[model samples]
Structure formats: C-alpha cells, structure tokens
Target: MTAMPTRGAGERLWIGTFLVLGSLTAFGPLAIDLYLPAMPDLARVLGTSDSLAQLTISTCLVGLAVGQLVAGPLSDRVGRRWPLLIGVILFTITSVLCALSTSIWVLLVLRLLQGLCGAAGVVIARAIVRDMFEGHRTAKAFSHLMLITGVAPIVAPLLGGQILRFTDWRGLFVGLGAISVLILLGCVLVLRETHPPHLRQRGGAAGTFLSLRGLLADPVFRGYLIIGGLQSASLFTYISMSSFVLRQEYGVSPQGFSLVFAVNAVGLVLGSQVNGALVSRFGPERLLTVQLVMMCVAAAGVVGAALADAGLVVLLVPLWIVMVGMGGMGANTTALALIPYGHAAGSASALIGTSQFLVGAAVAPLASLVGTDSRVMGATIALATVLSLVALWRVHHARRTTPAHSEPLTTTT
Candidate 1:
C-alpha cells in the first residue's frame, strides 16, 4: 500500500465549515430516527399492520439509496450547491406533505420522496469531505461528522418520544420539515462550491454511467462497498426492530425505549471518537479488521442472548457493542473506498451511500419478520457481520494480488 501525501496546512477546514457540513450529514439520520417512536402509533392511527408500517422505513431507505444514485453524479456535473439547494427545498415540501398524510400508503409515498430529496445532504456532505481531504484526514473528518450524525440518533428519538407526549406522529414530520429549512439556510450561507468548473465531468449521462462502471471495476472499492452495505444491514436490523422488540416484548414504554436507543447511540459516538483518535496511528485497514472481528463477536453474543431468552440487560450489552463496531468501521470503509476516486468524489460518495441504504432496505423487513423474539434480528445481524468480514478479507487480498501497474492501496500518512 502506498501512502498518500498529507494535505497542506492551508487546506484546513474552518470550524464553521465543519459545523455546516456536520448538519448536512445529519439529514438522513434525523429523518429516520425522529419518527421511530411513532411507528407503532402510526400503525394504529393509519389502520395498518406493524409489518406494513415498517415498510414505511423500508420505502424511505429505498428512496435514500435511489436518490443518492441520482444526486451524486448530478452534483458532480452541475456543482454541489444547486443540487443540494433543490434537494433540501424539495425535501421540506415532501416532509410537509408527509405530515398531512392520513393513509399509510400516502405516508409511505411521501416518506420515499422525503428520503430522495434529503439524500442530497447525506451524500454531498461526504463528497465535500473527499473534495478537501484525503486518506486518514478524510476518515478523521468523517468521524468528527459522526459526532453530529451520531447525536441525531440519540437526540432525534428521545425528542420524538418526548414530543409524542404532546403531539402525534404527524408532528415528527413537521419537525423534520422545520429542520430541513434550517439546513437549507446553513447551506445557502456557509457552503461554497467545492468542485470547480474546470474539474467537472462533461460527458453527460453517458459519462456518468462510464464513471460508475470505472469505479465498479476496482476490487478494493467493491470490497469496501460490500463491507459497508453488510455492516449497515446489521445496524438497520437493530433500528427497524428495536422499537417493537423493546416496547412489545419487554413491556417498555416509548420513553423507556428512547432511553435505551439513546444509550446505544452513545456507543456510536464513543466508537467514532475513538476511531478518529486512533486511525492515524493504526491505519484504516487495521482498524476495520479489528472492528469487523468485534462486530462478529458481539453479533454472536446477541444471538446467544436471544436464544437464551435472556433479560434486556444481557441483550443490550452485545447490541451496543455491535453499534460501536459499526460506528468505528463506517468512516474507515467510506474513506478507504473513496481514496482513489477524488476526481469523481460525488459519484463515489453516492455509490457508498446507496449501497448502505439499499442493503438496509432489504434487511429491515426480513428482521421485522422475527423481530418480536429478537432471535431473527440477531441471526440476521450475525450473518451480516460474517459477510462484512469476508468483504474486508477480499479488500486485503486484492491489495496483495493486484498488478504493480494498477492503483495501489493508499492511505494518508
């Protein structure tokens, strides 16, 4: 593996820039987590089954995935600011519409649109980081962003649960719309165009397809994508099921579930911060290997606890460990994947985000099938962990076996 040259001191990100970017990174999480507490109530209010209500989440995940595929390359071609502006505006509109929805089907459609537009913030934030940073610095920046993104999972759910005491689920969408408005103002004021006109890809749709094809050809990138997608599957399994499992099975209240959710989110915060601190010294690949192993072990423990029908304490312990491992590895895999694609950072970031949510969309429902018992969710997560390990192994193997003339596995010193 070759070492990438360190970025110059002059290229340092300003505190203001970091905050605006962090806000952008929080869009997807805010949209997803804020409404989680309302999902059961949503089912009853909308006159639908729990499984059908969960489909609302899956639909949003699909929208996030598909939206990134569109927004990323479009941003690369049209520049980041305009696409982002349009996305947030549309997202706000969709969120408002979602609040007005009385039917579960209508809500599902609106949520999909909301995810599609909100995806601009999620994908473009990473593209901007890749635009300015490289190697370990990129990873570190992402970890820092996770400080805010991780907080969304913590604060959004707790806030939602609290809000439920006063208003219903519709209020959550209204809140999301209001939040998007603030993010839009931040983008309009703080974010400058990162991709210069001279650097833009000019081949149009044909060119975008070609660029995607080129990225897909890289073994390292593919491996990292698989690793990321599967890791997300593990986490989304938890996210999509935790509300029901804790509330129905363990007889916990919405507020109690929110506290549990927040505690696990803290694991993400701690993991990301630790990864940021250690990534420069240990390198991303090494850290990723360790995280994958940790996730596998923790996921196995989750399965064990589930099978034993152990107490919530036993279950949460290993579940939190899995979240921590996911937090630590998420940045590393993304940074590693995008290292060689700086020229097409938007498209690359899009693919990474898409892979994650797409896999998440697929797994959410499967986990929902057996989520009442926790056994199926645990087994599903365990399977994802194993696949992630296999993906990481392929990344390592590809680095060793690729031709001398091919792109070398590189990291910033």
Candidate 2:
C-alpha cells in the first residue's frame, strides 16, 4: 500500500513507458481497421451474408463497450498491470481462435472475446496516464499517445490490403494475434503498476456501482462524455461506411481504399500533434470549443459535397478537416472528464470509453440502415457533429453559471 515514487521526466523510462502505453492503446483501432479491407472477402469465404460479415465488426465493438465497463472498475480495484496483461493474453488467444474459425458464427464469438480482452489495454492506458500526471500535463500526454496510436489506423488497412493480396481474410486475424504477442512482451517489460494497492477501490460491487454513479452524477463528466462519444461517432460512421462507399460506390480497389483511409488517418495524427502543442497554451476547454465549431462547419461541407455528388477530392477534403477536429476533441474531452476522478480513473475512463464505443456500435450498423453512399456518410457525420456542438454548449453554460470553487478545476476553463 506504499506510494510508488513518480518517475522523473526526461528519463529513458518515460519514453519507453509512453511507447508501450501507446502500443496498448493502438490495439483496438488496429483490430477494427486492419480487418476492414477484408470484409467482403471474408463474407465470400465464410459463406455468410454481408450483413453478417459486418456483424463481426459490430459484435467486436459491443465486446469492447462491455469490456471497458468491466475492466475499468476491476483495474481500479486490482491495479493496472495484471488486468492489462491478462487482457492482452486473452486477446491473443481469441484472435488466434478468430483466424481458425470455420463458421461466421464462430468467428463472431471469437471476435467478441477478442474485443473484450482488448478493452483492458484501451481503458487501462488512460487510467495510467491520469495516474502519472494531472491537469494540462494529462492533456499533453493524451495527445502524444494519440499521435503514437494514430499510426495504427494509418498502417493497419494498408497492411490488411497487402495481406489480402497474398493470403485470405483469415490471415488478417492471424497477423493481429502476432502483433498482440509483441504488445504482451512490452507490457511485461515496460508497464508498471500505476494504481497502487492503497488507492485501490474496496467494497466490491457496491463500491464499483457507487463510483460509477458518482461519476454519472457529475454534470461536467457527463457533458464531456457526451461530446466525446458523439464526436467519436463521426469517425466510426465513416469507418463503417468507407469500405463500401469507396469500393462499391466509387469503384476504388481495396489497395486504393487503404491509401484513402491512411490519408485521413494522417489528418488525425497531425491534429493530435497540434493539440499537444496548443493544449498547454490554450487550455483543453477552449481548444474543445474551437474544434467542435470547426467540426460542425466541416461536416456541413461534407453534406454539401455529398448532395452535389462531388468527386473524391471534394469529399475527402472536408472529411480530412473533420478528422483533425476529432483528434483535438478526443484528447481534450477525455482529459477534462477524468480531471476530477484520479481516485477512480479506471472507472471514469471506462465510462468514457464505453460511451464512445457504444455510440460507435450503434452508428456502425446504421450505415447500412440509412443506405451506404457519400450522402448517408455525410449526413451521419453532420448529425454526430451537431450533437457534439450541443453538448459543448451545455458544458459552456454549466461552467458559466457554476461558481468557480464548486466545480472541478478543468471545467472552469
């Protein structure tokens, strides 16, 4: 129960710690994006309907949503390292199972398990950052992590497309399993326990529920969670529809679609890098306000281009701008939400992550429901952006009326 000494900045350990945490954080995106290019091929090979193949993605997201809910509080009780390690190990095992599945049903089950285990990394990494730093330092750390983790989405689809060129869709899962093993090694060697035994939550399920309820009762946390979830939906909506719209609608090849996806991901990376620089100077709340407005404008542009039936160049420009806005919004909202809950960072992070993936899971399937075209994609992005703007406005209003000393520190900004 003794306090662990904080590691000083500028040490080799700091760099290694961030890299390992970043790698862990990247696993969810890698799992989702890497297999996207293979969706059609997967359907064809597994003898399932396209809807069912798409369920593979949806089910995995469901698992991720549920897993974070479970893992977050559990990590708060048990500390970070063991739960994370177990999660990675389970993820690796389930990924291998996904590769070996002979039926789409079997693959669906394994994908769910894979996502559940993978949630440990995604949720715990955020908690670890909160454990390590506070205030603007937390925002800076998150932005840096986004910069490191953003590379996964950029590379994953391209790698998946290349893997498809030689092998089948099943090979994609095998590759994910392999990459997870490397992450497992890094977790064991580089990740230290950030949540100490003394700080760990007790009273079991009652305590966990109380922790979650307390977070939910906080208007500031709720606002940030809504904004983050809705903003994230814009990205997920694009992810769910992109392969279909680019390949089926526009006749872009799989390789070409991967390149397109990577270009947008680069926009995300750039935004995260910019946010890292600006967060300390501008503050997360101000940065979030600016980015949400830009996102609204960019999303409106997307709607216009879609309605006009504009070409790829026209469509991608607005979408890239939206991605940049998302990158900025994500770090700030997360940092703001967790600022008050250092004691239960895992549980708070879990709530934020669960909200995001749940929104994403809901939106992903709706792409098909609404019909897959640029217009549908644009409309979905616009809707999510509008919701985000509403949440941001609520936060602004709440901050204005609430007295300075009564509110959480970050909300005042």
Candidate 3:
C-alpha cells in the first residue's frame, strides 16, 4: 500500500488501461441493477413494505456518495491498487451478506456496504483515465467506456427478470457476488497502478481534503459538476417513478413497460456516439449549451402534454428527447470538470460522480409525492433542465476573464 515511484502513462499502457478501467467501471451499475427485479419479492420475503424495501436502494447510493469522497483521497495516498483490492473484497463480502440476510435491516446495511465498495470502480476508473489521457483523448476514452458500461442498463434488467423466474431473490445476490469475483480478477491481472508515487502529494488526509477544497473553490469545476448532476437527476427521476407511472397508472404490464424502457436505451447509445463527435468540433461549452436548450424545450413539451391530458405519445416523444440530451451532456460536463485537474483526476472524478448521484438521490424522492401522473416525469425533467441551464451559464460566466472562444479544456484532463 506504500506509494510507489510516480510514472507517466506510457503508450504501451493505453489499450490495457482503457479496457481494464472500462470493465471496472461497469462493476457498480451491473451489481446494482442486476438484482433490482427482485425488489418486490425481497420485500415480501423480508416482511417489509414496498417503501421500506426501496429505501435499501437509497442507502446504497448514500454509501456511494460518501464513500467515494474518502476513497478518492485515500487512493491519492496509498495508491490506487490497494484501496481497489480492499474494496473488491468488501463488496464480495457484502454481497454474501445481502444474500443471507434474515431481515430488511440487514439487507439495507449490506446494500450500503455494496455501495461503499462501488466507489472503487467508478471513481478509480475515471482517475486512471484522467491520469493517462488529456482533453479530446480523455473524452474519447470516456466515450468508449460509456459505450461498454452502457450495456449494463440495457441488459441487466432483462437478465434480472429472467433470473427471477428460475431462482429465489437470494440468487440475485449470488450472481452479483460472482460478478465481484470477476471484477477483482480483472483488476488483479489487468490493471496496473497508474498513480505513481512521485506524482502523489505527501500531505496525507489534510493534503487530500485541501485538494477537494481547491476543486470546490473553483467556480468552473462546481458549475460542471452541478450541470452533470442535474443531467443524472433527469434520468434517475424517471427510473425512480417509471414502474408506478407506466404499469400502475397507465395499466401497462411490467413486460410492456420493460419493452418501452428498452426503446430508450437506444437513445443513450446514439447520444454517446454523437457526443464523441460533437465535443471535438463545437467544444464542450457550445455542445452543453445546445443540449441544455434542447432539454428545456423537451421538458416544456412533456409538461404541457401532462397538464393538457394528452396521450402517452406526447409524453414518450419528449421523454426520448430528454434522454438524448442527457446522453450528450453527462460526458461533456464530466470532461469539463476533470479538464482542469489532470494531475488530480481521482479527486476530480470523485467530486463529479458523487455530486451527480447525490443530487439524483435528493431529487428522486419527488416520485413518491407526485402519484404517477405524467406530471411526475414532466416535472422532474423540467427541474433538471433548469439546473443544467443555470449551471451552464455559471460555467460560462466564470470563464469571462479569459477569452470565451479559448478552449480551456483542450490541453488538460
């Protein structure tokens, strides 16, 4: 765990780094969602209400948000490898705990441990990518990562649905436990420590906390994280409420609802591909602005439809548009946030990732109050879009002293 001598990201390391890190990044989402279909069954088995069962999910997210802040800085000190190994072990143990839990409380606590370990994959992967690539290359690498990681959401739920038919809910956790083992094997064999000893600060926790202070103090950094967070909320809000709105309110079968969800995944893939192209040409600022505008317009349309009592098509169209905008904005804004901190990529990625998910967790509860009307989806999208526009303006305004046309993100992480 002692810091090793620092080394640059050599060309030979590029392909290995990209593939290893991308797979590592896929660990968390796949673990979380692959078991989600078992939630209702889990609730019944544990003798808990649906609301209490769902709180287990929120607790996992809470663990992710808080754990990443600690993990990022620790990675800076002890190096990326050990924290990652330890996290993998913890996650594996937690998955077993989840599978064996006799009560809802035990399951919820184990879920939090799973979230804690999740910080390793998401935070460290971003840091490693930032360590090696700068500007356009960094963005492109992330695009590739998203392309692979995107498959989790597209496929995990369906896989979960299938698994549920054949096995008990405990099997869901067992499957996830196997995924943890594979993730650890990948890391042990494929991922080398990218944070060289010399490149790290020696200030320990104080040094780490100060690095965070510096990032938070920067208006441009805060702006990018806030904007990215809002975009996440846009997507998660739908996820939080989708079943109730589509199945209960609209009288659709769960199978039918899953089909509709599958249709939206295509939009995400298309947007990620478009983002890699658009960012290089128009730059992150202009691209984010365009998407932010599109999102607001989409939100307005959906909201209007909801208020006017229009049909599902009215809602579906705007929802797709919103998804497309989210696909565009998430990567671009993350690039912007990390652009300034290539040297401290771990901390930067942690801040952005935590901000994005925490904001999402904070807003997603609105679904409980809204009662599955189209207004639930419409209102969530509108609010997230509004945050995006505001954050975009703040980023622009913070850069006013420099030339607006000058691309600050071109050379750095």
Candidate 4:
C-alpha cells in the first residue's frame, strides 16, 4: 500500500481546489447584488411596501444561514461535489421562479431558496481552503480567493443595471438563472472533490460541535470571529441602505446610485489586492492590527462628517480608506482563526459564515431605524471598527497564554 505524498501533494491540491471553488464563492455576492438596482421598481410592480419588498433580500440571508448548516456537515459526510452540484441546480431553478414572481411574498420564499443555494458555495469554498492550507498560507490563500470573490459586486450590479434598462426586474432573475447554469457547468467540468470521504468519518456532527465549542472557548478565535462578523455587518448595512441614503438624503437617482455603489465596491478589490501582497511579509496578525486602527480612524472620520454635515465625497474618502484595509482584514482574520483547527473545517466554515450573516442581518434593521441618513450608517461603521480592534487584542492575548508544537503554518487550519 502507498501512502499519499504529503507536502508535494498538498500544495497542488490547494491550487486546484481554490481555482474552481473560488468562482463558486464569488456567486454569493453576485446573487445578492445582481437585482439590487431594480429593488424600487420591483416593489412598485409587486404592489408592496418598500420595506416588505426588501424582505426578499432578508429572506435570502435567512436561507443562506439555514443552508450553511446543511452544507457544512453534508460536505463532511458525502464530500463536496454532490452537495455543491445540487445547490447549483436548486439555485438555477429558484432563480427562474424569482424572475417570474408576481408578489413580494412569493419572491421572498424563492429568495430564501436562493440564499440556501448560495450558502453551499461559500461554506464549501472555505472548507476546501482549510483542506489544503493553514496558517500563513491559509490566510494568504483566503486573500487570493477573496480576490476572486470580490469581482462579483463590482460586475454584478453593473450588469444588472444594464439589464434593467431592457426588461423589468424579473429580467435580473432570468440572467441569474443563466449565470448559475453556466457556473454549474464550469464547476462540473473543472472542480474536483476536495473533502475526500475517508478523511472525515470519525469527526461527524458530534465531533464537529465539540470542535466548535473548543474554538469558541478560545479568545483568539472569538476575537477574530467577532471582527469578521462585525466587519461583514458593517458592509452589508451600507449596501442595504445605500439606495435610500443616496436617493432620499443625498438626492442621487437610482442609476446614479448604482455607479456610486460600484465605486465603493472598487475599494473592495483594492483593499483585497493590497492585503494579498502585504500579508506574506507583514503576517495577518500585524497586518490586522494596522488595518483595525485605520478602520477606526475611518469610522471616526465618518462620524465627524455626519456631525459636521460634510459633503458626501468628503465622508466617502475616509470610507474608501477603511474598506481598503477591510479587504486585507477579511482574509487574514479567517486564516488566523482557523489555523489552529484541522479536523473541523466544515463546522468552522459554517460557524464563521453564520456569525457574519447573523450579525449582518441584525444590523440591517438599523437602516430602518436610522431612516436614510449618514447617521445610522456612520454608527454601523464605528461599531465594526471598535469590534475589530477589540478582536485584534483578544487574538494577541491568546498567543501569549498558549504555546504548543504546531503543524506547518501552511497546514495549521
């Protein structure tokens, strides 16, 4: 009997895994943003209140949360390939239903299904990364994957905006169905099974929950998780509320708003790419420290801008700076947190995504409370900054208390 080649085999596995999985992960942002431009129009057509119409988005979030639970463990049990294929097929079906929806409630249910479908891509993508790389390499690889996923927000809305010009918001769903089908085909042709069946039998759901408890009990993981969750919430809050903020408060049109949205998203790619280059030399811990501080500075600036009644451009400049740092923090934080766990990648991935979405879902209501101004949005930004900084400290504290012989940083998680 021949044992598998370890080091040489591992890197090759990682490279192949991320290439396909990264595209799947990118679909999450695409699903969320693809029809965003038509939200107002969709609400009017469906004869629903704007708030109720927005429930479609919320439904999707709920679905993603629910689906992650299913996909994470299922991946562990049956391997990654089948569950992902099924998810894509469901995503494709529901997307068609969404395009045909006549009422907000109908769309809501379909949106939930869409979210569940999308969740598989993200949860499995992370699990695959953990399958191959940990420590610095894990963090670095996350950055690269983040780079791949980051493209969705940039291109999706633009594409959606153009489509809305020709057809009703329903057309966006049609396009999504088409995109999902194409993506599914790409994955079928290219994506290999990364979570081999034999590698994960002993550590079933019970084992996964236990591993999760251990990670949760650790302050370093808690801090990183909190920062990750809060930062995600902060961005979701902005995206959710941007239309009202611009149209009502700043007096921008919907078309104009999409451009603004695209511009802000540019910061995502910028921050992510820079983080990729910097993490190797600086390390995630050190890089996060600086990024956290800058995020706070940006938050403080946003608050001051709202208070001082500064122009939108003035406030957004600081925000751009903050997101640039956030791009780096996003990947580094996950890698650092996961680096210690090898046996529970699926559960870990599930927990992290669930936490991020829950926090984001909770924070989304702030848009309603704050009522279309810089006020609540600014508070959300500050909240993310404060939490991320605290998380960095907790991670640092943990490093001091526990020191043990560990695997290669490349295989830490």
Provide the lDDT at 197 for model 4.
51
RMSD in Å for candidate 1, one decimal?
4.1
List pairs with backbone clashes in candidate 1: none
lDDT pick, better of 2 and 4: 2
The models' CA-based lDDT, in order, is 0.84, 0.85, 0.77, 0.77
The TM-score values for the models, in the order shown, are 0.88, 0.90, 0.91, 0.88
Cα deviation of 266, candidate 2, in Å: 0.9
Distance from true location, Cα of 164 in model 2, Å: 4.5
Report residue 143 deviation for candidate 4 (angstroms): 1.8
Instruction: Write down the TM-score for model 1.
Output: 0.88
Tell me, by lDDT, which candidate is best. Answer: 2
Candidate 3 lDDT (Cα, 0 to 1): 0.77
Residues 142-173, candidate 1, lDDT per residue (tens digit)?
Answer: 88888898887777877888888889999888
TM-score of 2: 0.90
lDDT (tens digit, per residue) of candidate 3 on 209-257:
8999988888888888888888878777887778777787677897789
Better of 1 and 3 by lDDT: 1
In terms of lDDT, the poorest run of 10 residues in model 4 is 404-413
lDDT by residue for model 4 over 221-303, one digit each (tens)? 78778988988888887877777777888888877886777777678777877887776677777787888898898888987
Q: Which stretches of candidate 1 lie over 4 Å from their true place?
A: 1-12, 37-55, 101-106, 163-170, 244-256, 308-312, 370-372, 404-413
Q: Root-mean-square deviation of each candidate, in angstroms?
A: 4.1, 3.0, 3.1, 3.5
Best by TM-score: 3
